[model samples]
Target: MTGSITIALDAMGGDDGPRTVIGGAAIALHRRPDMRFVMFGEEAAVRPLLDAHPEVDKASTFHHCDITVRMDDKPSQALRRGRRHSSMWKAIEAVKTGEADVCVSAGNTGALMAMAKVCLHTLADIDRPAIAAIWPTMRGESVVLDVGATIGADSKLLVDFAVMGGAMVRALYGIERPTVGLLNIGVEEVKGLEEVRAAGRMMREHDMKSIDYRGFVEGDDVGRGTVDVVVTEGFSGNIALKMAEGTARQIGEYLRSAMRRTWMSRLGYLLARSAFEHLREKMDPSNSNGGIFLGLNGIVIKSHGGTDADGFASAVELGYDMVRSSLLQKIVNDLNRFHTSDVPAVPAEQ
Candidate 1:
C-alpha cells in the first residue's frame, strides 16, 4: 500500500474509449513509473494502444471484456445490463477483490457510482456516500463534497461529508488539521436551512481534532479558499460547482474578446502572454479532473468522460496519491473518534 500503487482502469469507458483511457494511463506512467495498471476492456482495441506505449504495456495487466456501459445509460439500466460483463464493473471489482488499490473511470458518472456502491459497499457506520471534488481556490485547493451524488442530505449526512471531505484534504494536501466549513447562503447561523445550521453546530461542538471547523462559508468563500473542506448537500453543491465552471468559461471568453477588440489590447496580451497562460492553466478543468466518491469501502475516482490524455492522467495521479496517503484509513479513524467523542448521533433541530 505504501509503495507503487496498482490502478484498476475502465479502459472502455469515456467518450473515446480505450484510446483516451490508455493514452492517459501512458501519461500517468511517465510521471509515476513505479505505478502499475490493471486494465479492463476489449483486447482488440486496448492491446494495440498499449503496444504504442511500451512502458504502460510492461506495467499493465489487461482483462479483456467486450461489453461497455454506455454513457447515456441510466444507473438502473447499467446495473441490469452491464453488471459483471462490462469493463467498468470489472475495474471496480478489482478494487473490491483486493487486486487493485483504486478504481478509475472516465465513464458514466451515475453508472460508475452505482457499480462502485454495489461492489465496494459503504464503509461501516456510513449511510450514504458522497462525491468530493478538488476545487481550485485563491489560496490553493479545497475539497467540496456531495457534488451531484444525491439530491439532499440530512444534518448527520452533512457532518459526515465534512469529516469525509476533511480526510480527503488531509490525504491530498498533507494537512494534519484542515479547516472545514458548511456551505451556506450567508455566514450568519440563522441564514440557512436548519440542517446546515445543525450540522455546523455539531462540527463546532464536537471539537474534532482532525478538522478545524470554521463555521458557515458563503458561496463566494469557495473561490476565496475560506476553508479546506466545503460541506453541502448534493443539490446545492452541484449547482455551485456548475455555476463556478460557467463563470470561469464566461470570464475566459470575455478576456479573449476584449484582447481582440483593439490592437493596443493585443499588444498588452502579448506582453503578458506568460501570465495569461499561467492563469489559463490554473483555470483549466482538466487539471482538476477527478471527482472522488467518499464513504465507500474502496476508492473510486470518476474522471470527466470528454477529457483528454493529460486530464485523465491527472485523475489517475489523484487515485495514486489517495492510495499512498491511505485516505480510507484516515476517514475510518476519524469516524471512530467522532462517534466515540460523545457527539450526539442526531443533532437537535434549531
Candidate 2:
C-alpha cells in the first residue's frame, strides 16, 4: 500500500474518450501521489489532453494504439479484430507484462472481457471469470459477483464465485472471514434453481474456513446487507444491478419533481437541503462504478462507459486497492482451500 503502483489505462475506451480518461487520471493522481499510469490511445487525441493536466502528464507514460474497439462490437468480433492492436488490448497487456499492477478500462464490457480472458487467462481451477461489483447496502457495502460476465452457472461455478467474492471482500474491506450467500428467489432451502441449492448444500457441508456460507439470500436481502458477499449467475446478477440503478434514478427524479411542485414543497426542500445532499451522495451510482473481473490471472477493472471523471477515478482507485491488497494471491489461496476440501461433485442439472 505504501509503494508506487502503476495502472494501465484504455484512454479511448469510454463514451467521452481521452477527455474523461485524462481528467480522471489527474484526479486519481492528486489523491494517490504514488500512482503512475501507462496510457494507451491514439496520440493525436490523447496527448493534448494529457499535456493540459501537468500533474497527470508528469506521472503518465503514453503509448500510441491505432485501433479502438467499437462499443457495439461483439465479443467474438472484438477478439478477431482488436486482439493485439486495440487500445484496450494494449492496456491489458501492460498488466500481463508487469509494466502495471492492474488494468482499468471504460470500454464495451463484452470486448473487455474477451480481450482480458484471451490475454491474461483465468487463474488455475477457475472455469470462468466473473464481474464483481461493489453494492451499497444498508449496513455499508457488499460485494456481488457475476454481474454480467458470462451467463448460466452450474453448481461448481456458483461455489467458485463464492470463493472469489469472499476473497474480494477480504481484499477491499479487510474482512478475515467474509459471509457469503447465494442470490435466490427465497431464503428457503427448497426454493430457486437446483444448482443453487446444491451449491448451498455443498458450502454448508464443507464449511470452508475462508468464507461463512449463509445459505440462500432473497433479492431484498442484498440491499439489507444480509451477507458480506452475494453470489449469482450473470443473468440474474445483471438484472438486479440494472434494477437497483434504475430505482435509484427513479427515486431521485421523484424527489426533484416533488421539491418543485409547490411553494410549500420548495420551502421544505430548502430546510432539508443538507439531508437531501447526503442522500444524493449515498445513492450516486458513480461512487460504485467499477466492476472487477475476478478469477483472472491479472487484475482488470471495468468502468462504466458513461461515467465522468470522478467515476473513472473511482475505478482507478479500485484497481489501486486490488494491487495494494494482493487480491490475486488472496483469491488463489481461497480457491486452493476450497478445491482441497471434502466438497462433493456438482450435481447435473435436472
On residues 134-243, what C-alpha lDDT tens digit does candidate 2 reach at each position?
A: 99999999999999997899988999999999999999999999999999987766678988898887787786899999889988999999999999999999999999
Worst 10 residues of 2 by lDDT: 341-350
Top lDDT: which candidate number?
Answer: 2
Which regions of candidate 2 fall more than 4 Å away from where they truly are? 346-350
Q: Estimate every model's Cα lDDT from 0 to 1.
A: 0.92, 0.93
Instruction: Tell me the lDDT of candidate 2.
Output: 0.93
Report how far off residue 98 is in candidate 1 (Å).
0.6
**Tens digit of per-residue lDDT, candidate 1, span 294-342:** 9999999999999999999999999999999999999999888887788
Flag clash pairs in model 1. Answer: none
In model 1, how large is the Cα lDDT of residue 67?
89
